[model samples]
Target chain A: MIIYGSERVEDLSLRCDVVVVGSGAGGAAAARVLAAAGAKVVILEEGGYHTSFDFKQREREMLPMLYRDRATQRTRDRLVNVLQGRCVGGSTVVNMADCARVPRAVLEHWQRDFAVEIDTADFEAASERAEAALGVAEIAADQLNANNRKLLAGAEQLGWRRSRFHHNRTECTGCGFCLMGCAFDAKRSALVTLVPAALADGATLVSNARVERVVVRGGRAVGVQGVLTEEHGDRPAARVRLEVAADVVLLACGAVHTPLLLQASEIASASGQIGRNLSLQPQLPVLAVFSERMVSFRGIPQSAYCDEHLVFDPRVGMTGFAIEGIAGGPVQTAGLVGASGRDHKRWMARFAHTGSCLVLVPDQPAGSVAADETGRTRIDYALQPDVEQRIRDGARAAARLYLAAGAEVVVPALRPLTEIRNEADLARLDDVAVNPDATTLLSAHPQGTCRMGEDARRAVVDSRGRFHGLEGLWIADASVFPTSASTHTMIPIMAFADLAARSIAQARAARTI
Target chain B: MIPEIDRRTFLRGATGAGALLVFGGALPLGACVLAQASDPPPDLAVLSPRAWATLACFADHAIPRGGAFEAGASDVGVAGLVDGWLVGADSRLVTDLRRGLALLEWGPLLLGFAARPLTALPPESAGAYLASLTTSRLGFVRQLHAALSELCLLAFYSTRSAWRAIGYDGPIVLGLAESVELERR
Candidate 1:
């Protein structure tokens, strides 16, 4: 049931009961559920289908194959790099496997603000089902890597709200290569689990097929049209033009592409929210080199977390953010630590001893994703002043936590601060310019591009992920999230995707399709 | 054998690991090698020899030579990386990069500094010139520096020699054995 576009010979004309336009957590999960319900499913992925066996564990090699545009996605100002998986598994394949539940507070806010109609019990049940489906498990204390242990110790020393992280892995080995696509098949990404299960249930998956636009007729979505980038292998020789027809069309092309596809397809949102209200969890990494070896890249990339900064009170808005551990491969480490040059080299030389944590800001929907004249995705995003100030505060907090754990020198600022030896230098973070243009703010979780709500005036989809005007069209990805959730988005998005897919299945069962 | 990725611990980069893509665009070493094979890399997709020299000079100045850092910019062939990056990029970006490098090369003489090419200038002179562009009153000049420096830095640091100088122990997994191998990904 898995078809490689590289090997495809000629034009394609396929039909299915459900045609999903992505193969990430949401799309794969939906395919599995819909296929299990006896609905013929077909999933189309723009990127090549790669798994652990093909993971060479080299950044330059893997990135181009696994990530979209080789992970060079840029915000309008080119300040932040938006990294999302482009392969068959979508973002889940490259994600750090940090799974978190939907905070009741966020659900309550959604119900109150967007009027999304899901009760607490139903939401919890949906989440529970997803967790079980994905084989979500807890990280044991014995398996804590040195990098993770340091953050845990630091958080404990600082009295931060620290806890273990849950991940979707069967027998993970702490190899710390999740961001590079797990080499041992330990991460249990959708490629290994949901996609396979769906395939087992007779689902068809087409790889390297970039859907140019959704084919609409008489205001009803009938199928998708796209081009096959390769006849085989990893070459960019556009070959076959693909045409896929389906009873139901699901847009799960992540936050960025889903909205862009909608616009390109000329699907009217009526709510003016096709690509509006782009919510993001922006990152500011605070690095500190310890006297002892941390070797932050040795084990699980994201083993420990501190949610203490998630200072949320629907009344006052989300004030604080999360601080977690992260270290990249050598290339990523060298490229991101500082601006070009000697000091940047100095930071890399100390890579082994450096312990890094990011201050994550749960941001408002303060941006838009637009395609340029060439049809490339560009995010027009800016950090609000208050969020910038909070990030500054969180950077200091993370630095202090490292200092509390006895880091020798803390490099908190992206463009080399004077080196923090004590609280005095840490306080200077307030003096540093908080310009989003200059900051090394990276957005990890992007949601709400085509948000779901009750009102068509402000939302793109309904509670069940149905498009406002189209009957057989739906979205089951993070694009439909109304607000940014306060944790890793994998579980919440899958849970919601499962919910959305269930609705589609019900419609088919009732012959509504 | 590669030790298993432990699912037991609470690993984190708590601030959702920054959303942005790290480093420059797809850095396929194949393309980089092919691009550099040309002399001064003429028929260059992005930079001419003089312009390539400007980038080398700027990257060398940025990292400089001293301390434990032994390799300079051209030693690792950053121009090649830059060329490959530009070949796949929009012509506008490649043109912008050319324009910026051209300014760095010729801007010195026009602005009444020493008449030496930027590549041949002393570190202090080169440093001062780059600093001027970085802090230039014209925001355009500053923006140009940002674009130019990013590619230079990424290309320079991407070198194995540079990584060695920085004491980075290469990739995390050297290779996985056959026992636990799955079907080709």
Candidate 2:
């Protein structure tokens, strides 16, 4: 059994029944399935195993320790700096524990439009298994943090329906460090859940390995070739290239990079639709200040959202949007507030009591992910006209809701406001030109980079995740998501991975017979 | 139908052929692996001394002792902390942190002027110097002071002490049993 941090094996040509790359939710799910089915599985992860004990609260140290690109990989085109985990648990280690089921409509759309024939019954069954495996459940009302309560208060004042959101947490100690890698071994990340289960069921995990290319022969994936990168304290690190033959190769590198891999392989020749139609359902945050100590810091990170205007209804498209409650520390708040000198001091002073809510808009699938001249990712996306208007309208609604909840000031991302001292000040937001260029837009759901469809010319992979016309090659991450769903994408991606693993297992059994 | 499938098949072949070309052309042993450097361990302390000083001053400002400014600005192993933080490992923010510290000389200048080390200066003088640096337009002093202040606040708030100072009731200590069990795991 290969636990994390094992010394290098001298030999290069190692064989395995299956090889899963990237130990995120999706990859981990697939690894567990294959290992449990009594297959020799070798899971290669680029990041090392990180435990809660190693979770430093400091961003300067922790960012490099846990996150990819050291948390400095900014969207050069947009005013957003994305952060994703690079450790054994992947993003799950640092993600706020919000587990929402895939919206039924999204599944229906997948079936009707995309030739993926997963019905409501199949989806429900898959979701049930995934939820059970993940220990997913709702947060009780009594467990609602001060931040969540304020969001509820605002929702109540606005006469909007609200309820506690579910999470994958088993016994959350109410630690504010969920978004910054939980220090207490409370949040159930893949590092704790699927990876461990997979290991226990006889899986071989090789950390510090980077897969460069998947070798294919006669339209079949033969194996993979990559380097194992290790950092020696001061000596200029070590790199050893690896060549492994496997029966099946699962690509779970993630949306942003999977397309790069495929493009590197020059595999999208049929229609060259390999890395197209990237959707980063961009989100903008709005902070509301209250006189009373909201203490928005201590709670589940994001537990609710205003769905009042959420539907196929175009009127609600950008009309109004606000989440349960979004909170962070003073430095993070200062970065967002973008004020210097005494005004910044004032913002920091009220940081303890400041209530924050993010307004997210489902960007109408308009972005493109392409490699630059230097072959690095160049994510270029412009807000559509309707999307820009929706942001302004949504921001205004958030301001009104805050004021209704007795907030003294509403600091919107793109509005000019001295402070909302009275209810009449809400009207000023209408004229506040919410500049899409200037306003902060972050993306958690990066999907459709490697889309699945009926036509091989249109999609990189088929409905079952197999690379189109290729044997023993499949993608099992957010890259396989044909389109972005309304809510979070982690659970849905993991479900799809589980389904893909089942298909691979059935194929393997059939071949053996 | 044949062309479409052939295109897909040909694409797969091209991918395989590309990998084969790279593998075939490369000098297997000496080329792929980068040459390892055998340089002496840097006086890790030498590179980041200025950054350490700035961070030390900043930490002092944020968590000074007593009610008074000079009297209260406290000091711990902040220099050592910053030094450790700078050289410990690879991080995006702190990659050239020591290099960035050269831009802020307020901490070093104050350290030079103090009756004792800036870490050991009387709380009153420390407070006064901090205030002057913030308020005065002494170009280098102001710039360095501002930088130190910013760096310190970030460092302090990010540490366990910030949580303690703010009365945040998050986890602080690990239980003995848990530590032992972790060792086993």
Candidate 3:
């Protein structure tokens, strides 16, 4: 049964076999598996329960409704805007629906550098299950919108490696509003898949319930306690208290939040690695104006990517960058124009002819998440020197790609309106400072905050996602990734969560026996 | 060893001191002391009167009327919309924004563009001052400019009135006749 905590006037108490905090890709997947295994699971989601019907496809309305901190959550320095969903399905509900597995090199890096061991066959099986459940398939050739086609064409002209992305969307109406929620329900997010399956299997979901802390007794997590908040808005009013007693407590709040919850619960690791090693995988938007009307916002926003520049090292995993086709509504697009008054309006006037792509760069874990003096979450991330160079190189490469694709002018979202008319003008980017606020950078994939490994001195959770030195406490989200999972993290997160859930279920069965 | 002053002179000095204190306290209350002509929105929720006036002026300059579009941020009440959005935002963020707006208003003086505030400058001069902020040597100043610029652009373009000029057809979901397909597990 699904309960709207906002409607409750009295305090609530419940007992369950498993209490999962968060209802995103990981929490929902784990909840489904545990529920199917006959564990009485109770899922507590801090955000409200919203479905496709509630999606208005308007940026102003949907942003505040579906996103955390109204989609304004930024790093401590305000250099990177970290966008994560705060509604029922977490980020999976608002993501671009790109599905990818953890690259082999990344897995190897985890095993080599982090001592994180995973059975290859088991992981593959879990990934296969997730893909099948989500109806993951390659984007059909006809489904490539003008923006994506431009990306593919550019890569082809430059003889760069490119491919159509596999997505979890089916019967998509080509509405270009995926960054907002998908009103058509075509994107098979965790909200429509695992969350519903878990609920159908007798898992109880409480919406608008924020889990503040885990209740630990005798070195084991016994329950979780928090408050039930109002249904909507960035700062919802706390209405009532909520407590859930469970044999196992699973935290799947995204990388930034899961670590905060652990720290608030006083569950410090011996390694002091609770909120270290944050990887933002920041992406920069590059716009190209074409002669013809591309009408880029009519179809799927992101369907193809160019991986020619993406590099993978045996030691460090994924590095370098990948360029993916992207478009947004007028409001989001205007924010990237980097001009004011007439100049800005002139750019937006040609909105139909503008094609955009994001330069996705994978970086080493070089950030941390902590609470400030005022008790607000503070994500501290500054671009390292190498990452900044890579970003600049990536931007130049993207501009070259657009120029190769016959774009009239290529514009990287930078201040002072740095425009690349021809290949010679690409050098202008070198003079541009890639410092904070000098360019627009956004992070949709934030991982590795509370990383997983074998050593208690280095990792917050073990290989099986069990919190080190703590019994009955587990983590099953992107927070457990030892490094950057991939360019896209939905599928990898789900697969890892599936494996973690099975481990938890087996442990419970073993204890019962 | 004290020298005695005239009683009339002492009374005058005390009265003048009281007047200075009263005027000094009231000066800050006139929120937009530099731009006394502008007023805050009627439905203010979070922003103070000075912040509201500064933001409104910034919005006007950032997305002024009569360029490629007829509707500007001021025409769509972008500042008012942002004020409403800030109502539920984090208190710290709200405080930072208030300070940022104040800085923007007084930026003209600090940047040596003019002795007056941003709102007091002519439309062209105000636009130039805002442009100068984008390339400012100070990172926080540039950040403030970028923040307000983005907020104004987002708020302005989000309105339906700004759609036609940009060639957007708005959302298509509301007009769909067919039902969306659902695949159950």
lDDT of 3 by residue, A258-332 (tens): 999999999999889899999999998999999999999989899999999888888788888999999999988
Worst 10 residues of 2 chain B by lDDT: B1-10
Retained true contacts (fraction), each candidate: 0.32, 0.06, 0.68
Model 1: per-residue lDDT, tens digit, A361-420?
888888889887755577888878878888888888888888888888887646544477
State residue A158's C-alpha deviation in candidate 1, in Å. Answer: 2.4
Candidate 3, residues B1-87: lDDT per residue as tens digits?
001111222232234333433333344433343233455677799986656777887887778788887877777788887887667
Give the TM-score, chain B only, in order for the candidates. 0.62, 0.42, 0.70
- The candidate that wins on lDDT is 3
Model number with the top TM-score? 3
**C-alpha local distance difference test of each model:** 0.74, 0.63, 0.84
Q: Which candidate is the best by DockQ?
A: 3
Q: CAPRI verdict on model 1?
A: incorrect
Candidate numbers sorted by TM-score from highest down: 3, 1, 2
Q: Give residue A94's error in model 2 in angstroms.
A: 1.3
iRMS of candidate 3, Å: 15.6
| Model 1 lDDT per residue over B1-185, tens place | 00011111101110111111121112221221212222465456666665666666666666655544667566766776767655544444454455566556555664566574455466677778777765666545555565556566666665667767766665545555423563353
Candidate 3 regions off by >4 Å?
A: B1-40, B107-115, B175-185
